[model samples]
Structures are given as C-alpha cells and as structure tokens.
Target: MAKEKIVLAYSGGLDTSIILKWLKETYDAEIIAFTADIGQKDELDGLEAKALATGASKVYIDDLRDEFAKDFIYPMFQAGAQYEGQYLLGTSIARPLIAKRMVEIARAEGATAIAHGATGKGNDQVRFELAAAALAPEIAVIAPWRLPEFREEFPGRAEMIAFAEKHGIPVTASAAKPYSTDRNLLHISYESGVLEDPWFDASDAESKGMYLLSVDPEDAPDQAEMIELEFAQGDVVAINGKELSPLEVMEQLNELGGKHGIGRVDMVENRFVGMKSRGVYETPGGAILFAAHRKMESLTLDREVMNLRDSLITRYSTLVYNGFWFAPERLALQALVTESQRNVSGTVRLKLYKGNVIAAGVKSPVSLYNPEIATMEADPTQAYDQGDATGFIRLNALRLKVNSGVEQNQK
Candidate 1:
C-alpha cells in the first residue's frame, strides 16, 4: 500500500522547515511542500532545493503576487478595511489566499490532508483551517502545534533547532533574537522577542534593527516628496500619471514610501483567539495607497453614502481579521462596497514626509462640489438667498427649544 500523502504550506522558515521533517518522520507520509510567492521577494530564492533536501517528495512555488494585489489587497483597500484603526490587515489578508491555493494543490496531487505551521494560539490557524473547511470540506486538516505529542517532542525553538541538527536540515534559526516575522508586498510585521513587551520602545537601538522595509523617521531626508495618484472606480490606476499594473504600482509606492519613512505602527492588537499581541509593522506602500484612495473618495463620493460606508468599516474590518473572507456576510458587504465605488474616480495629490502621508489636493470630473453655492462673496443674481437661512435654522432649532423648556419645568 502507498503511504498517505499530505500537502504542507512551506515558507523556508524555521518553524515550517522543522514541521516538514517532523511530518515525514511521525506520519511516515509523503510530503508535498508548497510555497506561495506573494511578493516575498528574495525569500523564495532556492526554496525548491531546500524543500527537497528537507525530505519533501515534491515541491511547488506558485507566484500569486498579481492575484494577491488585484484580488485580495485591492478589494480590502476599496472597503477601507483596517483592523483596530492601525493594522492594514497585512498578514490577516494573506492567509486566505495561501490557504485557497493549498486546497487547489491538495486536490491536484491526490493528497488526503493539508498542514500548516501556524501555532494553536494565533489567528493564522483559524484563517487557514476555516478557509480549508469552506473550500474543500472533504480534505483533512493537520495542525502539529495543537498536538501534545508534537509539543512534548519539541517544546520551543531551542528544541526544534536540536531536532533540525539531528535530521541534517539546514536552518539559520537560533535561540537568540527569536523575533517572529511575517513579510509580503503590502507590509512586514515583527512580533514576539523584544516586541512582546508593549512598552518597549521600538525606536531604541536593540529593537530598531528588526525593521527591514523602511528607515527610521529620524534618519529620513529633510525634504518631503510630492506624488499624484489616479483612481478609477475606487482602484488606484496610475501613479504620478504613469499607468502600471497592480503589482508594479505596489512596487513603486513601496520604494517611494519606504524612502520617506512612511507607514510604521506599533500597537497591542486583539487576536481572534482571545489574546492581545504586541506587534510592530512597516506598511509603507499600503499607507500611501490608503491615504490617496480616501482623498479621491472625498471628491467623488456623496456625504451620506460615504458615511454609510464608514459605518460598516468596523464590521468589514472584523470580518477580514477573523478569517471570514469566504463567508456570506463578507460577500454581501463587499457587494455594497463595490457599489459605493461606482463613481469614485479622481486624482489626489499627496506629500510624503517622515512617518506621514499628507493630502495636498484632490479633484474629480464627477465632483459634487459647487463653487457657486460654496463661495462667500456676494453675487448680484446668484441662486443662493441669505434670507432662506432664517426658516432653516428655526425649523432645526424647534427640537432643542422644546427640550430646553422640558428641562426648565423638571428643575
């Protein structure tokens, strides 16, 4: 009889590398390692060789960068989704895409089970398993960190390192500097280690070395840089008047935003699994895109429509944070969000300085702003009549007048 096959989401990282070897030894299963390339850049280099050397029977590295930007990232941005008003949902948004591809691979390879390296305590596990259950109900899901046997064998990173040495798996991990990190095109996040302390100033020398995407605000250049972004139906179509693909747009903005020290955040966020985790993130490109998108909306969207969409931001953001990307409610909400963007086409000018994205100007051909009604200067035959304010104010003040009379009577 052939051994049971399992597909493991491999990242060429310490935890996933160790999990690859452990799965082979414990289950005696044929491991098909898979890595999703969602703009991790050079991290994907030579990963196939490493997977094969680490006991994988087959290896796959899929480039999902364009899909990630076009499908996942843009839609979330269009909804103005932000977790806790700080995080851009960088790692939160990537998990569903990775899990979706893992399901596809599992079906193609005739694999019976799918595995991931997310620990039992974190939100990634929920995101991965929920997506797998929704997408492929028949396939079994394996999580080693939740098993007592696995935890007993390798209690921590130190033990995992020893196990890796015994298995002859090459790893650059060590007990020192055990800061956990997750990286992609949108952002790079650092947690655990020194960052676990909420009060630990990340700007200090010891913690500062962990940042990879952007420079420190103090080290940024003295002058600010201005750029223009063009949008069509709520999506950024061009930067500085140059049309580019979604991936190219993100790349360009990341370079420009990182140079100006934009998009750095530190906060204690509530995880889906009922814990508060301290995290430091650098989301240079995403910050710029978000600011520019909102500026464009201010010019094109109606006041009430924009307010209604804003009211749903918390719910929308929670759905993304809790791994409900495939849920029915999220789909319904996304339909409304898409409808709200129907006329959100415009240009926004912005200035990027040290740790700031400032809006300079915004304009749209479909803008509702009327200078004739807005101008304070008197016009001989203008439509506006100053006499109309008397009735408007009196009608609006009726409720307040009645409330004041009632309060006086009570006193």
Candidate 2:
C-alpha cells in the first residue's frame, strides 16, 4: 500500500516549519508542503528549499495575486464590507482565497488530509477549516495546535525552537519579531506580542520600523498629492489616467497611498471566536479604493438603494469576518451588492496628505445629483415647488398635532 499523502499549508515560517516535521513524524505520511504567494514580497525567498529540507517529499509555491485582488478583494469592497465599521478586512479576506487554493491543491495532489498552522485561539483556524469543509467535505483537517498531545509537546515558542534544532530544521532570528504581521497585496496586518496591549501607542510603531507599507504620517511630505480614480461598476479601473488590471490597480495604489502615508488603522476588534483583539493594519490601496468607491456611489446610486445596501454592511462584514464567504447567505448578499453597483461608475478626485484620503470632487454620467433644483440661490427651472412644503409638512405633522390635542384634552 502507498503511504498516505498529507497536504500542509506551509508558510516556511517557524510555526509551519516545526509543524511540517511533526506531521511527517506523527502521521508517518508523505508530506507535501504548499505555500501561497499572495504578495508577501521577499517572504517567499528560499521557501521551496526550506520546505524540502524540512523533510517534505514535494513543495508547491503558487502565485495568486491577481485572483486575490479581482475575485476576493474587489467583491468585498463592492459590498462596503468593513468589520466593526473600521477594518478593511485585509486578513479576513485573504484567508478564503488561500483556503480555496489549498483545497484545490489537495484534490489535484490526491492528498487525503490537509493541515494548517493556525492556532486554536485565532480566527485563521476557523477560516481554513470552514473553507475546506465547504469546498471539499471529504478531506480531513489536521489542526495540531488544537490537539492536546501537540499542545503538551510544545507549550511555548521556546519548545518549538528546540524541537526544530534537534530535528535539524533551520530557524532564523528574524522569525521572532516584536509583533506578528500578515502581508498581502491588499495590506499588512500587525498584531500579537507587544501589540496585545491596547494602550500601546501604535504611532510609536514607526520608530521601531514595524510598518512596511507606509511611512509615518508626521514624516510624510509637506505637500499634498492629488490623484484621480476611475470606477466601473464599483471597481477601480484606472488610476491617474492609466487603465490597469485589478492587480495593477492594487500595486499602483498601494505605492501611491504608501508614499503619502495613508491607510493606518489601530483598534480593538471583536474576533469571530468571541474575543477582543488589538490589531494595526496598513491598507494603503484598500483605503483609497474604499473612499473613492463611496464617492462614486454618491453620484450614481439611488438614495433608497444605497440605504438598503448600507444596512447590510454590518451583516455582510460579519459574514466575511466569521469565515462564511462560501456560505449561501454571503452569496445571496453578494448578488444584491453586485446589482447595487450597476450605476456606480464614476471618477473621484482625492487629496492625499499626512495619512488622510480627502475626497475633493466626484462626477458620473449616470449621476442623480441635479444642481439646478438643489441650488439655494435660485432655481430657474422651478422643478421643485415652494408651495409643496405646506402640505408636506402639515401631513407629516398631523400625527404630532393629534397626539398633542389628545394630551391637551386629558389635561
């Protein structure tokens, strides 16, 4: 009988490194290490070699940047999905795409089981497992961190390092940063370690060189930079007069937003697993796109239609944050969101200065804003009748008037 093949979501990091060796030893199976290249930059350096040296029978590093931006990020942005009204859903959005690819790889490689290094206490475990269950129910999920035996064997980071050394797995000093970060084309998230303290001054993260995407707002250039974004059906199509692909849009905007010190968020958010966590995220491109899309919608989307979609932001955001991207509710909600963006095509001019993305102007061919009737000085067309207000106000006040009369009669 052939040995069982287990596909592992390997990051080439300390945790995944140890897990790679442990899985091979514990299961006595052929380990196939897989890494998703979703714009983590140099983190992919020597990953294949590292995984192979760590006792993997085979290694696969796949690039999913364009698919990540177009399929995942753009759709979520169209729904105006912001977890807790602040997070751009950077890390939350990336997980589904990663997990989907992992499941696909598992099927292609004929692996019976898939494993991840996400801790039991974190949201990634839920995301990875849920996505796997939804996409491929037959595949088994092995979460070592959640297993009592695995936890007992390595209770702390020190134990993992010792195990790696004893097993001849390479360990680097830079793997242990003051805080942990998850980077992709959309953003870089900073959490854990010193960031666990909510009172910790995130502004001080600059001095420690903790941020990779943007500079400190105070150190940003003195002059503001003006940029224009073009949207087509709620997705950015052009930046500064250049038509680009979804991947290019993210790459260029990330550069522009980072140059101006935009998109830094620090907050305590409620994790899906019923716990509050402090996270700092740098989402330069995502921030710019979110603001520009809102401005574009203001010009073209109907008032009530926009309101209806706005009411679903919380639900939609929660769905994404809670690892329900493949759920039916999210799919149904996405259909409504896509329909709402039919007329949300426009261009928005913005001023970027010191971490602020200020909207300067917006215009669209399908704009509903009629300035003639809106002008306070005078309405030459007389589209809105001044006399209409009397009946409108009287009808609206009729209930109030009746309630007051009843109170007076009682008195």
Candidate 3:
C-alpha cells in the first residue's frame, strides 16, 4: 500500500505548523503547504520558507487578495449579509474563498486529501468541509483537531510546544494571548481567550495592537469628509467620480473611512456550532460600502421587491454564517436576491465623521419615490380620492369593532 498525499491549508501559525509536523509522522503522507494571501497585510512574511523547513515537501503561496475582494467581498456587499446585523461576515466570507482555492491547489498538486486547522468547536470546520464537498467531493478531508488520537496526544499548547521542540521545528511560543483574531482587507475579528470571559472589557486598542482597520475615533481628523459612490445593479462601480476595480474601490474606502474611524462593532453572537461568542470587529471599508450601497437601493429598488428581499436577508445571512453556502437552498435564494438587486443602480453620497456614516443624499433614474403622488400639500389636479381612505380604514377595523360589540352585548 502507498501513502496518500495530503495538502494542508497552512498559515505558519502555531496550530498549522504543528499539524504539518504531525501529519508527516502519523500518516507518513507527502505534505504540501498551501497559503492563500487574501489580504493578511504583513502576516505573510517568510511563510514559504517556514513551511518547507517545517517538513513540507513543497510550499505554495497564492495571491488571492484581488479575487477575494472582487468575487467574495463584493457579492456579499451586494446582499448586505452582515452576520447578526453587526459582523461584516469577515471570517465567514473568507472561509469559502480559501477553501475554493485549496481545492484548486489540490488538483494542481495531485493530492488525495485536504486538511485544515479549524477546531470542531468553531464554525470554520463546517465552512471548510462544506466548501470542499461542494467543489471536490471525491477529495478526502483530514481534521486532526477532531481526531481522538491527535487530541489526546497534543491535549494542550504545552504538548504542542514539546512536539515542535522534539522535531527540531522552529517556533515562537510566548504566553498565549488574551484573544484570537482573524484579519483580511474586508475586516478583522477578535474573540476567544480572555474575550471568553463575558464581563471583561476589551481595550480600545487590543493586546495584539490597535485594530487593523482603524484608529481611535477621538484620534480621527476634526474635519468631515464626503464621497459619492456610483452603483450598477447593487455593486459599487465608481468612487468620488473615479471608476475603480473592486479591490481598488475597497482599498480606497479603507483609507477614507479608517481615517474617520467609521466602522467598529462589538457584539455577542450565536455561533453556528452551538455556542455564543463575543467578537469585536473593525470593518472600515466594508461599512462605508454597505451604507452607500443601501442608500442607492433605497432610491432604485422597487417597494415590493425591496420588501421581499429585506425579508430574506436575515435568513440569507444565517445560511452564510452556518456554512450552508454551497447548498441548493442558498443558490436558489441567491438567484432571487441577485434578481432583485439588478435594478438597484444609481448614485449615493455619504458623510464620514467620527465613526458614523451619514447618508447625505441619493439619486437614481429608477426612483420609486414620487413627490407628486405622496405630498400632503394640495394639488388641484390630483387623481387620488381622499374619500376612499374612510371606507378602507373602516373595513380594516371591522373585525375588531365586531368582536368588541359582541363582548359588550354579552356583558
């Protein structure tokens, strides 16, 4: 029998580094390290050499930042799928894209199985596996964190450190930090460790550093700034009179909005894996884009269509959060959601100031708000009959009136 090749999603972090060493020992498998650079900022330094030196047969570092912004981030912005109405779906959205790329790399490398460092207790495991099943079902999945033998062998951080030392794998082990964080261009999320203590207050600047996306609101510039966004079918096309690529547009927003401290959110949310997790997030660029896109939708989206889509947004958001993104129901709902967003084209102006995104104004050729039909002031030629409302109201009230009358008669 021959050993199978397993390509592990590697991040040069403590967990993935240990997993790389462990896989080589346990499975005797040819381990290929795949690192996707979806806007990790500077955390990607020396990852390729690190993976190879740590016993990987080969290493791949793919630049997926542009694709991440254009495909995953923009479509999510189009749907306005904020998890629990506060989270920008940062970690959630990143999962599918990374997993998709993982499958692509696996096919390229001729690996039979894929592995990731996501814990069974978190939502990420479901996300990684669901995406794998959707894109490449025939490929096997190797989840060390879930395996009884691995969990028993390396029960804690101390044992992992011991394993690394024994294998002569170079690693840095400071006392574990108070919180866990994930970062990308769209947003950064922090939770776990001391954050698990419900009553603990997170410092404005977390222990890792100030939030990746913003400065403190008090430190923002004194002057307000305004920008205009042009939309075509619910996606941002131009910024402040200049057209930009999707990644470029988001990058611009990050600069403009972060300087003003426009996006910070803290909340305790119900995780899909059945636990409540408290997270603090910075989504400066995404927040600005969301506010602008929604303002445009207000102008161009039809009343009934808008209402219907609004009804599904929460459900759609839940599906994404729960890792059901590759399911048939999600596809069906997305089709309907995208169909409604097609007419949502126009321009929106916004003011950024001290963490607030104020909708300055909006305009669209398809606007459904007609002043002539809705104005309270008299228009002599108005075709609307005010008299009809008297009957309409009476009819709506009839059931309540009848029920009360019966009660009074009985009394």
Candidate 4:
C-alpha cells in the first residue's frame, strides 16, 4: 500500500529541520518539502539539497516574489494598513501568500496534510492554519508546537538542536546567537532572544552591525538623494521616469532606501495571542513607497473620501495583523479602499536623507487643489467670491449662537 503523503513548509532552519525529521518518523508518511521564495534573497541557497538530505521524498521551491508584491503587498498598501499607526504590516502581509502557495502545493501533490514551523505563540501559526482552512478545509494541519507530545520531547532550542544533531539534520542554530527573524520582499523582522527585553536599545543594533537591509542613518550620504514617483490609481507605476514591474520596483526601492538608511522601527507590539512582544524591523523600500503614496493621494483624493478611508486604517491593519487576510470582511474593506483610489494618480518628488523620506513636491493632472480659487492676490478669475464669506460665516455661526443663547437663558 502507498504511504500517505504530507506537505511541509520547510525553511531549512533548526525548528523546521527537526520538524521535518520528526514528521517523517512519527507519521511514517512520504514527506514533500515545499519552500516559497518571496524575496528572501540568498536564504534560498542550497535549500532543496538541505530538505532532501533531511529525508524528503520530493522537494519543491517555488518563486512567488512577483505575485507576492503585486497581489498582496499592493492591495494592503492601497488601504494604508499600518498596524498601531507605525508598523507597515510587512511580516503580517506576507503570511497569507506563503500559506496560499503551501495549499496549492498540497493539493497538486495530493497530500492529505500540511504542516508549518511557526510556534504556537506567534501569529504565523494562526495565519497558516486559517489560510489552509479557508482555502482547503479537507487538508489536515499538523502543528507540532501545539501538540503536547511534540512539546514534551523538545522543550527548548537545545532539545531541538540535539534532536537535529542526532537525526543527521544540519542546522545553523546554536548557543551563541539566539534571536529569531522572519524575512520577505517587504521587510525583515527580528525578535526573541536578546530582543525580548523591552529595554534593549535598538539603536545599539546599528553599532553592532545587525541590520541587513540598510546601513545606519548616521552613516548615510551627506548629500540628499532626489527621486520622483509616478502613480496610477494609488499604485506606483514609475520611479524616476522608468516604468518597472512590481517586483522590480521593490528591488530598486530596497536598494535606494537601504543606501539612504531609511525604514528602521523598534517597538513593543501586542501579539494576537494576548501577549506583548518587542520587535525590531528594517523595511527600507516599504517606507519610501508608503510616504510617496500618501503624498500622491493628497493631490488627487477628495477630502471626504480620504477621511473615510483613513478612519478604517486601524480596522484594516488589525485584520491583517491578526491573520485574517482571507476573511470576507477584509475583502469587503479592500473593495471600498480600491474605490477610494480611483483618482489617486500623480507624481510625488521626494528627498531621501538621513533616514527621512521628505516630500519635496506633488502634482497631478486630476488634482483637486485649485490655485485660481485659493489665490489671495487675484480677483480677475473670481473663482471664489470674497463677498460670500459674510453669509457663510453667519450661517455656520447660527448653531453656535443658538446653543449659547439657550445656555445664557438657563443661567
């Protein structure tokens, strides 16, 4: 009889390596290791060999960079979904895409179950399982971290490391550096280990040369760099007059923003599992794009439309942060956000210097900012009649006068 097959999201890391070997032994099933490349860069090196050597019947490494940027990142950015008014949802935004790909691989391979390396304490576990449940309900999820038996055998990193050593599974984790990180096209996040302490100085991380995507802001070039971004319906279409695809745009901006030392954030955020966690993130490109996009919107979006969309930013950001990417409510919110961007087309000039994305100027053919109507020195156009202020002020003050009169009578 053919053995049941299980699809595992393998990252060639310590936890995943141990999980891969344990799954093969415990389930006695054919393990199909799958790795999704969503702009992890050199982290994909020798991943297939590592997975195969760790006892996998088959290995699939799929590149999902383009789809990740276009379908996932673009839509979220359109809604301006920044968690806690600071986090750009970089790590949060990438989870659903990764899980979606895992489900597809599981379906194509006819695997009855899917597994992930996300810990029970983190948000990724929720994201992976929820996405699987939404996409393919029949497929079973094997989360070793949540299982009592699995936790008993491996209580900490040392246990997992010893298991990997005994099982001939190569791992890079050791006692020296114990922090954890998650990376993608958008950004890289560092947490746990020494970073677990809320008082740890994130600025010191720069001196220690811990950042990967960017240099220290103090080390940035003395002269500011100037660039222009062209947008069409809230999506960046061109950078400095050159049209590029979404993936290319990300790559280019990452390079530029990195050189300028932009987009480093350190904060203590509330986790979905009802705990506070300290995380330090480097999201160079995403910062630049977000600032430019908001500047572009200022020139084109109607005041009311912009305000209505801004009011939902918190809700939209929370949905993504809590791993509800595939939820119906998020989709409905996306539809509304998309409609709000119908005329958000413009070019924004920016100055990049010392970790700052300074908006230099903005212009759009469909701009609502009418200079003729707003000018104080001109009367020839008569676009806005100065005489109208008398009636307008009186009408607006009527409610205030009525309220004051009532209060006075009561007194």
Candidate 5:
C-alpha cells in the first residue's frame, strides 16, 4: 500500500521546520512541504532546498503576492475592516488565503491530511482549522502543537534547535529575538515573547528591531510628502498619477508610507479566542490606502448610505478577525459592502508626515457635494432656501418642546 500523504504549510521557520521532520518520523508519511510566497522578501530564499534537505519528499513554493493583494487584501480594505479600531487585520486576513491554497494543494496532490505550525493557543490555529474545515472537511488536520508527543519531544526553542542539529535540518531561527513575527503584502506584525506583557513598551531597543515594514516616526524625514491616490469603485487603482497592478500599488505605497513612518500601531486587542493580546504592527500601505479610500468615499458616497455602511464596519471587522472569511454571513456582508462602493470612484490627495496620513483634498465625478448650496457666501441663485430652516427646526423641535412642557407640568 502507498504511504499516506500529508501537505504541510511550510514556512522554513523554526516551528514548521521541526514540525516537518516530526511529521515524517511520527506518521511515516510522504510530506509535501508547501510555502506560500505572499511577499515576505528574503524569507522565501532557499526555502525549496531547505525543505528538501529537511526530509520533504516534494516542495511547492507558490508566488501568491498578486492573488493575495487582489483577492484578499483589497476586498478587506474596500470594506474598511479594521479589527479593534486599530489592527488592519493583516495577519488575520492572510491566514484564510494561505489555508485555502493549502487545501487546494492537498486535493491536487491527493494528500489525506494537511498540517500547520500554528501554536495551539494562538488565533492562527483557529483560522487555519476553520478555513480547512469549511473548504475541505474530509481532509484531516495535523496540528503538531496540539499533539502531546510532539510537545514532549520539543518543549521549547532550545530543544527544537537540538533536534534539528541531530537530524541535520538547517534552520535560521535563534533565541535572540524573543518575539514572533508574521509578514505579508499587507503588513508586518510582531507578537508573543515580551509582547505578551501588555505594559511592555515597544519603543525600547530590544523591540525596535522587530519592525521591518516601517521606520520609527521620530526618525522619519522632517518634510511631509504629498501623494494622490485614484480609486475605481472603492479599490485603489493608481498612486501619484501612475496606474499599477495591485501588487505594485501595495509595494509603492508601502515604500512611501514606510519612509514617512506613516503606519505603526501598538494596541492590546481582544482576540477571537476570548483573550486580550498585545501586538505591534506596521501597516504602512494599508494605512495609506484606508485613509485615501475613506476620503474618496466621503466625496462620492451619499450621507445616509455612508452612515449605514460605517455602522456595519465593526461587525464586518469582527467577522474577518474571527476567521469567518469563508462564512456565509461574511460573504453576505461583503455583498452589501460591494454595493456601497458602486460610486466610490475618485482621487484623494494626502500628505504623509511622521506617522500621520492627512487628507489634503478629494474629488469625484459623481460627487454629491454641491458647492453652491454649501457656500456661506450667500448666493442668490442657490436653490437651498433659508426660509426652509424655520419650519424644519420647528418640526424637529416639536417633540422636545412637548417633553419639556410635560416635565414642567409635573414639576
């Protein structure tokens, strides 16, 4: 009989590296290591050779930067999904796409089981398993972190290092950096380690090095930089008069935003698993995009429509943060979000200065803003009649007046 096959979400990191070897030894299965190339610059270097040397029977490295931006990142940005009012849902958004691809690879490779290196206690485990269960319910999920035998074998990073050395598995992880990080096209996040302490200041020397996507705000250039973003139905289509692909747009914005230190956030967020976790994130491009997108919508979207959509942002954000990317309610809400962006086509000029994305100007062809009626210069030809306000205010204040009369009578 053929050996059972397992598709492992391989990152060439310490945890996944050890999991790859451990899976091979424990299950005695054919391991196909899969790495999703979601724009983690040098992290993908030599991944194939490393996976092969670490005992993977086959290795698959996929370039998913464009798909990640267009399919996952852009839609979430369009919805203005910001978890806990700060997190751009960077790491949270990437997991579903990665898990979906993992399931696809498993089906294509005829693998009976899929594996991930997400810790048992973290959100990634929930995200990965929930996505897998939604996408491919028949496939078994092999979570090494949840396995007792695996935990016993490698209790800590030191033991994992020793095991890798004994098995000739080359790894680049070290005990020096106490935090764990996840990076993608959208953003870079730093968590765990010293970050577990909610009061730990991230500005200290030890934590400063963890930032890869943006510079320190204090260290940024003295001058502010102005840029224009063009949007088509809510998604950013161009930057500074240049039409670029989704990936290129993200890369360019990230470069510009990073130089100005425009997007750095540290907050203690309520996790989906019912715990409070502190995380530091650098989402330079996403921050720029969100600010620009909102500015454009302000010019084009109607007042009541924008208000209704804004009301749903928190719920939509919660759904995404909770790993409901494939859930029906999320899909339904996304439909409404997509409808809300129908006329959100415009250009927004912004000034980036020392961690602030300031909107300078915004305009749209289908804008509902009327300069004539809005002007305080008192135009005679303006259609908005000053006489209308007397009746409007009296009608609106009738209930208030009636309530006051009732209270006065009682007194």
Candidate 6:
C-alpha cells in the first residue's frame, strides 16, 4: 500500500517546522511542504532547503504576489473593505489564496489529508478550513494544534523551542523575540510578545521595527511627491502616465508611497473572536490606492451606486476578516462592486507626504462633475431649474410642517 501523504501550508516558521517533523515521526507519513509566495521577500529565501532538511519529502514554492495583489487585493479595494474602519484586512485577504492553493496541491500529490499550523484560538484555522470546504470538500483537514496529542506534546512556544533545539531543526523562535508575526506583500502583522499589553506604545514608532512597508513620517522627504494613477473598471492600470499591469502598478505605488510615508495605522479594534486587540499596520500602497480609487468614484460613479457600496463596506470587510473569503456571499458582493466600477475610468494626481495622500486633481471620461452646470457663481439655465425648487422644498418639508402643527394643537 502507498504511504499516506499529508500536505501542509508550511511557512517554515518555528511552529510549522516542528509540526512537519512531528507529522513524519508520529504518523510515519510522507510530508509535503507548500509555501505560497505572496511577496515575503527574505522570508522565502532558503525555505525549500530548510523544509526538506526538516523532514518534508517534497516542497512547493509558489509566487503568488501578482495574483494576490490583483485578484484579492484589488477587488477588496474596489469595495473599500476595511474591517472596523481600521484593519485593511492585509492578513485576512491573503489567507484564502494560500488555502486554495494548498487544497489543489493536496489533490495533485494524492494526499489523504491537509494540515496547517494555525493555533486553535486564531482566525486562520477557520479561514483555511472554509476555503478548503469551498474548493475541495473531500480532503480531510488535520490541524495539529487542534489535536489532543499534538497539544499535549507541545503546550507552548517554550516546549516547541526545546523540541527544535533537541532535534537540531534550525528553529528561528527565541525568548527575546516572543512576538508572532505574519507577513505578505500587503503588510506585516505583529502580535503577542510585548504587544500583549494593550497600552504598550511601540518604541520609535516611526523608524521602529514596527512598520516594515513605510518610512518614518518624520524622515519623509520635505517636499511632497506627486504621481498620477490611472484606473479602468476599478483596477489600477498605470502610474504617472505609464501603462502597466495591475501587479506592476502596485509595485510602483508601494515604493512611491513608502518613500513618502503614506500609510501607517494603529488602532485598538474588535476582533471577530469577541475580543479587542491592539494592532499596527503599514499599508503604504493600499492607502494611496484607496485614496485615488475613492476620488475616481466621486467623479464617475452614480450617486445611488456609490451609496449602495458605502452601505455594504462593513459587511464585506467582516466577511474577509472572519475568514469567509471563499463564501458565495462575498462573491455576490464582489460582482455588484465590480459592476459599480464599470464607468470608473479616470486618472487621479496624488501628492504624498507626511502620511497624507492628497487628491491634487482628478479627471474621468464619464465624470458626473460638470463644473459648468454646477457653478453657483455663474448662471447655466440649461441644466438648472429655478422654478422647480418651490414644490421640491415644500414637499420635502411637509413632514416637518405636519409634526409642528400637531405639537402646537397638543400644546
């Protein structure tokens, strides 16, 4: 009989690395390590060799940066999705893509079950399982952190560190660096460690180790930098009049915005697990992109359509944050958000400086902002009707008038 094979979403981190070896020794099953490349530059270097040495039979490295930014990030940006008005869903947005690929590899490798290192308390376990359920329902999921024996074997990071040290697993976790971090092209998230205390203000918040994707606002260039961004059907297609692919556009914006210190957010937000957690995020490119995208909508999108999207942003953000990215409801909302951006073809000039993305100017071919007709300083009778205001105002005020009359009669 063929040896049972299990594929794991391997980050080559301390937890996953230990799990890889544990899976091989305990079950005597073949272990395949799969790493999704969503722009963790230095993190992926030497990962394959490390995984193989640590007990993985086969290793798969996928460069998902372009797909991540374009397919997942861009569409979420189209919806202006922000969980609790602070989190850009950086980690939330990347989870589904990684989970989907893991499922595919499981089928290709003929694996009996898939595994992840997500802790029992986190949202990632829910995300990985939900995406797997949506994409490949047949594959069994083996979450070691959720397993009784696994939890007993390694109760905390200290035991896991001892396991790695005893086995020579080339572990990276240390007592000094106790924080858990997750990184992608979109952002880097740091949790636990010194951050467990809600009031611990990150030291040197500007040039500090906290923000990787942004420069210090104090260190930002003295002069504001301007760049023109082009969009079509809600996807950014160019920067500074140079046409480029969606991926290239983000790459450029990331560099540009980072240099100017454009995006950095620190907030205490309500997590889906019914707890308030403090987090800091650096989304330099996303911040600039959202600023430009909303400016474009002001020009091209219809009032009702924009209002509908505005009302639904919270729901969309919740879906992403709660790990329901692959749900039909999310897809349905994306369809409507994309439909609303059909006429959102335009260019916006933005000046970035001191953590600010200022809309210097904007223009769209389908712009509803007609300066000639909207001018209050001058007269344009073709579109403006002075005579229509009498009934319009009276009809709108009727409810207020009736309420006042009723109150007077009671008095």
Clashing residue pairs in all predictions, respectively, total 0, 0, 0, 0, 0, 0
- TM-score list, all predictions: 0.96, 0.97, 0.94, 0.96, 0.96, 0.96
Residue-by-residue lDDT tens digits, candidate 4, 1-411: 889999999989988889989999999999999998998989999999999999999999999999999999999999998998789988899889888988898889989999998999998899888888888999999999999999999998888888987888888976465578889999989889888888878787433566889989988999999999999998998999999898988989999999999999999999999999998999999999999999999889999999999999999999999989999999999999999999999899999999999999999999999887777787677878889999999999999999999999998
lDDT by residue for model 5 (1-411), tens: 989999999999888999999999899999999999998999899999999999999999999999999999999988888998999999999999999999999999999999999887788899999899999999999999999988988888899999989999887776688888898998989888888888898977666687888888888899999999999999989988899889999999999999998889999999888888899999999999999988898889888988888999999999888898999999998898899999999889999999899989998898988888788989666698888999999999999999999999998
> Can you give the lDDT of residue 330 in candidate 1?
92
lDDT of 3 by residue, 76-131 (tens): 77777887788888888889888998888889888899999999899999999999
TM-score quality measure for candidate 5? 0.96
In candidate 1, what are the lDDT values of residues 73-189, reduced to their tens digit?
999999999999999999999999999999999999999999999999999999999889989999999999999999999898789989889989888876566688899989998
Q: Which stretches of candidate 2 lie over 4 Å from their true place?
A: 173-176, 205-208, 403-411
Error of 2 at 403 (Å): 4.5
Q: Which ten residues in a row have the lowest lDDT in candidate 2?
A: 171-180
Better of 2 and 5 by lDDT: 2
For candidate 3, the TM-score is 0.94
- 3 or 4: which has the higher lDDT? 4
lDDT of 6 by residue, 101-162 (tens): 99889999999889999988778888889889999999999999999999999988789999
Residue 250's lDDT in candidate 1: 90
lDDT of 6: 0.88
- Taken over the whole model, the C-alpha lDDT of each candidate is 0.92, 0.92, 0.86, 0.91, 0.91, 0.88
Which regions in candidate 3 have their CA more than 4 angstroms from the true location? 203-208, 380-383, 406-411
Stretches of model 4 off by over 4 angstroms after superposition: 205-207, 402-411
lDDT of 2 by residue, 1-411 (tens): 888899999988889999999999999999999988899999999999999999999998999999998999999999998999799999999899988998898899899999999999899999888989999999999999999999999999899989998999997745447888899999999998889989889888443488899989888889999999999999999988999999999999999899989999999999988899999999999999999999899889999999999999999999999899999999999999999999899899999999999989999988999999899877998999889999999999999999999999999
Regions of model 5 farther than 4 Å from truth:
380-382, 404-411
Q: Candidate 5: what lDDT? A: 0.91
